[model samples]
Target: MYTVSVMEDFIAQHYLTVPDPGPEGEVHSHHYEAELTLSGPELDEYDYLVDIETVEEVLAVVRARYEDALLNEQSKFAGHNPSVEHFAHVVWDLAADELDTDHLSTLTVTIWEDDDTWAAYEESV
Candidate 1:
């Protein structure tokens, strides 16, 4: 399958809600990098997996919403842990809502909370 990916970086604050969260229980900032990958067996009429510029535009909005914001305050994160895993799904949901998926086979959201730590969520379109 062909894959097209776009990435955006932003800083966001959040505190874990799980028990014995320790230092993580306190709000902190993560220099996050989120990458969205679109995959399909076939390309569109223009022979593109999707338009890169269009994806970048969508990611710009995504970055704007999360940059310098507190994750726990967002409706999508309400009662959620705000962990990287959950964050990945949250981003995936937002991107999916804004992007056309009829021609795509799968969408994967990978988020790096730090240089070495990351999580991902993937699903069929």
Candidate 2:
């Protein structure tokens, strides 16, 4: 299988809603880095698994919605913990809307909360 990936970075604020949580329960900001990967056995007419420019544009739209904002307030996480894993799923959902599922066979979204930690969500055909 062949894969293609695109990455982007953005900043956002959020707080976890875990019971008796620690410092993460308090609102804080993160310099988030998100990577989206698509894979398939074949490429499109352009000889590419997917268009990098299209991926970039979609990522930009996603970033614009969350950049410099409180994710917990504006996202479905309003009453839940906005963990890295959850954020990955959010990114996947957003990107899924833009991808051409007809050609792509797999999708993975990775979200880095910090230099040492990250989470990912994946879907396969």
Candidate 3:
């Protein structure tokens, strides 16, 4: 299978809402990195899994939507903790909605809250 990926980094703030969250319960900023991957067994006529420019365009909008924003206040995070795992799923939904997935078999969104901590959500297209 072939895969194409686009990534961007942004700063967003959120506070864990779960009980006994400790310091994480306080609003904090994380330098977040988001990566979106498209995969399929066959490439398009243009010899690409998906158009890189198109992916970049979608990623730009995704970046702008979250960059330097308060995740807790975002509608997508409404009633949900802005954890890395949830962030990945949210990003996946956003990107999937904007991209053409007819030719892809899988779409994956990975979110890195920091250098070492990260979470991912993958779906079949």
Candidate 4:
């Protein structure tokens, strides 16, 4: 399948909600990077898996909502953990909410908490 990916970076703060989160339970910030990938067996007449610019526009909007904010305070995470895994899934949902995916077979969202650590969420669109 052909794949097209777009990436962006933002900053956000969060504190884990677990009973024994320890250091993670404390508020902290991350220079986060989110990459969204769209893949499909067939491309449009233009031969592009998807428009990179369009994808980026969607990401920009989504990322802006979380920029410099605390994830725990967002209504989206009211009953959820603000971990990398959940964050990636939330981003994927945000992107999919606006982007047309009828031509795509799969979507994957990767969130980098840091250069050395990351989490990804993938599923059929």
lDDT of 4 by residue, 1-125 (tens): 89988889999999999889999999999999999999999989998889899999988987889999999999889999899999999988998888999999999999999999999999998
lDDT of 1 by residue, 5-84 (tens): 99999999999999999999999999999999999999888999899998999889889999999999999999899999
Instruction: For model 1, name the residue pairs that clash.
Output: none
Span of ten consecutive residues with least summed lDDT in model 3: 54-63
**Overall lDDT per candidate, in order of appearance:** 0.95, 0.88, 0.92, 0.92
Q: For every model shown, what is its TM-score relative to the native structure?
A: 0.97, 0.95, 0.97, 0.97
Candidate 1 overall Cα lDDT vs. reference? Answer: 0.95
Model 2 worst lDDT run, 10 consecutive residues: 72-81
lDDT per residue as tens, model 2, 1-125? 88999989999999888888788889899999999999999987789888899999989987998899898887556666788898898889889987777888899999999899999999984
Best model number under lDDT = 1
List the candidates ranked by lDDT, beginning with the highest. Answer: 1, 4, 3, 2
Count backbone overlaps in model 4: 0
Question: Which residue runs does candidate 1 get wrong by more than 4 Å?
Answer: none
Q: Ten-residue segment with the worst summed lDDT in candidate 1?
A: 53-62
Q: Which 10-residue window of candidate 4 scores lowest in summed lDDT?
A: 55-64
Model 2, residue pairs in steric clash? none
RMSD after Cα superposition, model 3: 0.7
Which residue pairs collide, candidate 4? none
